[model samples]
Target: MKKYKYPSVLTIAGFDGSGGAGIQADIKTTSALGCFSTSVLTALPVQNTRGVRKIYPIPIEAVADQIRAILEDIVPDAIKIGMVHTPQLVETIVSTLSGYKKIPVVFDPVMVATSGHRLIEEETIKAITEKLFPIADVITPNMDEAAILADMKVVSLDDLYTAGKKIKQLGCKNILLKGGHQETPIITSLFYDEDGHYHSFESSKLNTNNTHGSGCTLSSAIAAYIAQGKTLYDAVSLGQQYIYQAIENGMDVQTGSGNGPLNHFFNPQKLIKNEMV
Candidate 1:
């Protein structure tokens, strides 16, 4: 008899040679959450903890090939998407992922980097809005990204809800509007559901420069929990808690001269329990 394999999650994102964000961080977070992770690199970036130097987007056909290979052998329990450089790439991803409606898809709208660089082209944003937004199970966008989606400034919590509602019009079933830009003592995140209800998760903002992968980590955690049969609300809540704790744990670790990566392995819970225990 064969033993059961752990749930597998697929991350479609960029590659960070610094290993602090993108595919590297997604793999770390998913593995820490006790899920197997497979990734398809979207962009190869010349970056460090400080900032991005250059980005090279992969050909669309290569991206499709990677996705096809993964789905053929190991059907993913969940999928997390990030950083597609062009409208064409976004179209390709949506076309490929549309058939996988059985699995949850967590889309993170990564517009700007922590160092204030634009990650996606203007035309690609239009593509994401028109082609992919309607199909995502949940779309996670920070205040800045939310503002871009809403075509207005999201200056306060009230604005976040407005932005979320407007984003839902673009077609996501749910929206997780992140409040990391609010500059408050507490970091607040809002989850707006399809039925017009909203939920909030708040935690004390840790003072640190080690937040390179917080959004990717949170979105992937949500995917992992959903793969394990948790509801969207529960997944987002628990995912936020996991990220907050990881950020707190790694607040002091100086990974590079600039920002650092979160501590993905600070406390990992294994899926298989020891019989002796």
Candidate 2:
């Protein structure tokens, strides 16, 4: 008999009843990438593809308890964080993971939803920058989020470059500034690291409305690859490829009336099991 353990990724985020984003998207992406997935719900949002109506944040103690329980038994190889809606929640998460500095933490500064709903409080944004940014191995912020974090209107490539530099100065070791909002045929995502090095990934923008969970999916994909021991650069590149394919595959599939989710399991992997003699 043989038993094998799979690489694991823990996602600390909100729960979207819509299942297109947040913990749901993170779990789907992690599992699709062949990593075992665990999650801690930070908030529960009454949301669908159309929009988010209300958000119920989980108690700080409960959030802390979930992380402690998981770390005591199955410490994750990597972690993905999203949607911390308050300063207290940010402090709770930072405190919980501070002991495990070796684990790669991919933080998606989820300040706003795809449907233009604000997700985080104004003070929470400040807390994420001050508390979580320094500890994050990589922070993925889309155009809107980058704008808020950088305190600038990011409307052009030069603006993205400037914003990336500014965000790196704010204690983040690595930054992936997503350029999906650019009104262009190609989406150019920028990657800036602590060594003053930058890389650009350009992909043809898919003409689709089903991009509700793309940001969450990308961050989790990166975490999954990192959990499998991929370099930060490789993880970002591979994660981008994975999200691109998911979007392309899901472009035509209708999930809801508004923006829908990516086909996360577009290319699914078979689960491995232990055999007993």
Candidate 3:
């Protein structure tokens, strides 16, 4: 007889009490993708479909304690990190994760707002650049975040290559520059692998305000697939497909007034079983 377990992903993110984004969305995504989800809350943002009003930061030590607790028990196959807002938190996560260096880490650099405002202070950005970027297996940054990381304007598809290379030079193993923020009808995402090859993924942009947690959902899906032994390229490709369906399926469904959320459970998957050898 053989024992079995579900593939798991540990999401380190903020709390979205609305259950649309942050850890809530992460959990929904991983669950739908047939992976067990664990989480560490870094901040509690008082947000809804409208917008984020206030963000209460979790203490640095408390955040670290949560990470350590998860790492010690029911360990994850992959880690998805989102919304580390402060310098000290960044350092603490980096230091704690340092001991367990081999796990695959997917980082969604979540500070750049939809309107292109740099959300965090300068020093926090510095810590993320210097400490966190190096450890991430892949960093999924939107055009706005990429512009900030690469120190250049990423206004066109042509700029994604240059910006990705520039950010890649910052020491991250891979970059997935998402073009969903573009005003164009067709959105294309460029994945720059660790080997320096660029793979392109495109989808027709659906017109909808229900895209609140799309980023969190996409990154979580990628981590879930990675936990299930998908290759980096495959994980990203599948993630794009999953998010596209989620958005398309829920485009007309009303959830809130401002920006609503994707349909994470439009097609839920059964928990995947892995043999415990």
Candidate 4:
């Protein structure tokens, strides 16, 4: 009898040695959400809670090989992309994943780190906007990233709406404009669908500094839920809830000297079994 496998998500991103963000966070979030996780490392960034020291981008060929090796065997049900630090890397990834258009892709435009370090070059940003954005099922960009992509400030809700619209014009089918950077009592994460409809997700802002991997975690959680057969709206909604709980659960726990990580396993679950087994 053929053994059934769990729903899986492939995360292509940088490697954060601190385990708070990047590939580590993606894997943790996907697993916590009950999906098998795979990864292709784009860059090896010497980073921690304090900040990013240096980034060693994996050779474009090596990056391509890693992705190809995984897709040829354990093709993921969904894909989550983050942190391509160069135009060459962006082009390589976009070209490689072009054949897998049917796979749902949740892309996090990780141009800058939480510690204010620029993780990507300007040319790389252009490559992502021109190539990856169009193919991605959805792109998750925070206020700062949105501003850079849309070429406008994203401090106000109106600004967020404008930025979301502008980014959508860049060719992405859907947009999730994260509102954590807004100085408001509530955090509002807006979801813009392909049909130009908007779904607003608002939650009470939890005051905490341990938000290092929040963006990466949320995007991966969204991918996991999508792989589990949830609708885009439901996936985003539930992913937000999961991230909120993770943040609330770890609000007090100290993990590092600077910004810390969320408790990814705050509510853990076993790998979903195949019912026919």
Measured over all alpha carbons after superposition, the RMSD of each candidate to the real structure, in angstroms, is 2.8, 2.2, 1.3, 1.4
Candidate number of the best lDDT:
2
The residue-by-residue lDDT of candidate 1 on 1-277, one tens digit each, is 3447677789999988888889999999988898889999888988999999999879999999898888888888899998887988998888887655557789999888877778878888889988777778899999889988999999888898888888888877899998877777887889989888888888887888898978888899999888777888999999988998999999988999988999999998675321221
Q: Which model is ahead, 1 or 4, in terms of lDDT?
A: 4
Q: List the residue pairs that clash in candidate 2.
A: none
Q: Which 10-residue span in candidate 4 carries the lowest summed lDDT?
A: 268-277
**lDDT at 269 for candidate 1?**
62
| Candidate that beats the other on lDDT, 1 or 2, i.e. the better one | 2
TM-score comparison, 1 vs 4, better candidate:
4
Against the true structure, candidate 2 has what lDDT? 0.91
Which window of ten consecutive residues has the lowest lDDT sum in model 3?
112-121
Q: How many backbone clashes does candidate 4 have?
A: 0
Error of 3 at 120 (Å): 2.2
True lDDT of residue 50, candidate 4: 93
Query: Against the true structure, candidate 4 has what lDDT?
Result: 0.90
lDDT (CA) for every model shown?
A: 0.86, 0.91, 0.89, 0.90
Query: Higher-lDDT candidate among 2 and 4?
Result: 2
How close to the true structure is residue 91 of candidate 3, measured as C-alpha lDDT? 90
Say what the RMSD of model 3 is.
1.3
Q: For each predicted model, how many residue pairs clash, with residues at least 3 apart or on different chains?
A: 0, 0, 0, 0
- In candidate 4 the C-alpha lDDT for residue 62 amounts to 98
